[model samples]
Target chain A: MPSELELQISPIVQESLVHNSRTLQNLQSLTASLFGVSAGILGLESYDGFLFYLAFSLLTSALFYLVRVAPSSLTAGPRYFRGPFEFWAGGLMNGLAGFILTWTLFYGLVRA
Target chain B: MTWISKSITTLGGLLLAHACYSAREHSALQSLRAASAASLTSLPSVTTSLPLDIIIETIVATFIILLGLVLGTRPLRPIEWRVWAGKIEREGEEGFIDGAGEVNKDYMGNPFSALESRPNFVDIRKQRREFAEWVKKGG
Candidate 1:
């Protein structure tokens, strides 16, 4: 979090912050279900399934950074995001429910 | 760019569906073989994981779809006010367009436009002089 004094000096654009985070959230949620489908197809169970989700979620973040955040942000620190945590790990919990939903559904569908 | 991402996502979806079907078939076949073998020799039923090709296809399809989605996302804006305002000044609506090449609906250009176009700043005398000149020259 930026200090109040720091924020006063370099104000934040609320709309841009919302737009950037919303874009990232949408991508994360969509890809979480995709990862779940792949995990199900691979017949991952229990810890294996969770691990797959974790690994793929990080991969999604990395790919997003490489594609979207890295080009313009090469000099400046993550201009679109509030902080590193918001850019990277914030979506982990956001998409976990969707991931498990699709994971269980496809897991049962494939096995049956 | 939008069409490219859409086509890539569609191709990935097709690949994922194929991999799912292959895995289902492989599982069904394994169960059938296990059933027959158990009936003949009283052996424990065997369960085999998805084949390597199916796993690879699923992973590859997922990655491709992820790439398409990330590509499809709207362009992000800088959060700091100066950076954001500078971008607006530099790129105008061009920088704020989405993947479909349409300007975003929420894009309100130039936050200080109201200040720049203040009523007090209007050149009423110049406007009146121009109006009088036009009247004198015409009927």
Candidate 2:
């Protein structure tokens, strides 16, 4: 069930969904590569490497929102964010697998 | 055609990866020679190779390039009418009625008669008149 806040905002549109998904994909891929580089440089290992990725992915999501979204209206309409999940924190979960793949590759290469 | 294109793309990607790996290997060998010139005998010669960073970067860059090429080359299919109509209606700030349905219904009953009648020629004189009217009105 959608919350009252979700109802107050404009309904999600297909075009916006398509556009946002493409943007999210680009962000995930770029951030994944960056996370790999940082992890390799920092010499993080095993569990610590994973933790670094988690923290950075969330940070990337926040930064993406602040840079791309927050300047616009928040609660009014489709002119702002796509939806609550996309606007706030869904990018972190979306980026996780890509981040892990790159982080592992970098960690193995650097530590080797 | 799609299958052929997919196969070609796969082959191209493999060739690109192989070419990138060989180029990196050659550069690494050259760098090793340059490093040896400074009397760095302590450096491991036999195991000398491209750094992990470089290898990862080459692979990632190649992958992204190939992915972009594949995606970019794929033919764009026509948008569905409902989706197109919805977009048009939204932009126009109006409700959409399926105009095609009315056309189809009319054409279905008298298909042969409609096919027999040809469309009129371009009305150049009327267009000139409209342009003259526009100029007269300071449009």
Candidate 3:
């Protein structure tokens, strides 16, 4: 989190912040369901399934950074995101429900 | 660029669907075999997991889809006010175009444009002269 003084020194654009976060959230939610489908096809269960979700979601963040954030933000460090945590791990909880929903549906479909 | 991502995503979806179908068939075949074996003898039937090929296909397809999705996402804007304003000044409308080659609806152009083109500073006589010349030339 940036200090109030730091924020005042360099004011943030609220519209840009919202745009960036919304883009990331959209990608995370879409890929979370994709991961779940693959996990289901692999017959992963319980902890294994959750672990698969964790690993792949992290991979998604890394790929997103490489493709988008890293190109323009090499020197200043992710100008679109507020902090490292927001860029990397913020979407974990946002997509968990969608992941589980598709996981169980596909798991049952494949097994049945 | 948009088409590239869309095609890649479609290809990945096809591969994933095929893998899912293969896994389903494999499980169904295993269950059928298990039932036959159980009826034929007293020994318990062995359960088989998905083939390695299917697992690999599923994982690879997922990765391709992830790449496509990341590529498909809209370009992000700088969060800092100065950086954002500078981008608008430097690139104008070109800076805010989306994947479809259209200007973003939210793009309002230069924020300080009102100050730059204040109506109060306009030369009324200069505008009236231009309008009169146009009328005289045609009408």
TM-score against native, each model: 0.92, 0.41, 0.93
Tens digits of per-residue lDDT, candidate 3, B1-139, equal 9999999999999999999999999999999999999899989988977889999999999999998998899999999989999989999999999999999999989998888799898999999999999999996
Q: Point out the worst 10-residue segment of candidate 2 chain A by lDDT.
A: A72-81
Task: Report the error of model 1 at residue B2, Å.
Answer: 0.9
Q: Which pairs clash in model 3?
A: none
lDDT of 1 by residue, B1-139 (tens): 8998899999999999999999989988998899899889987876766778898899999988988888888878889999888888788889888877789999999887788799999999999999999999994
Candidate 2 global lDDT: 0.50
Query: Candidate 2 chain B: worst 10 consecutive residues by lDDT?
Result: B99-108
Estimate, for each residue in A31-87, the C-alpha lDDT of model 3 and write its tens digit. 999998899899999999999999999999999999899988998743898889888
Where in model 3 is the C-alpha error above 4 Å? B119-139
Point out the worst 10-residue segment of candidate 1 chain B by lDDT: B42-51
lDDT for residue B87 in candidate 2, whole number 0-100: 43
DockQ, all models: 0.82, 0.04, 0.86
Clashing pairs in 2: none
The collision pairs in model 1 are none
Top TM-score hit: 3
Better of 2 and 3 by TM-score: 3
- lDDT, candidates in the order shown: 0.88, 0.50, 0.93
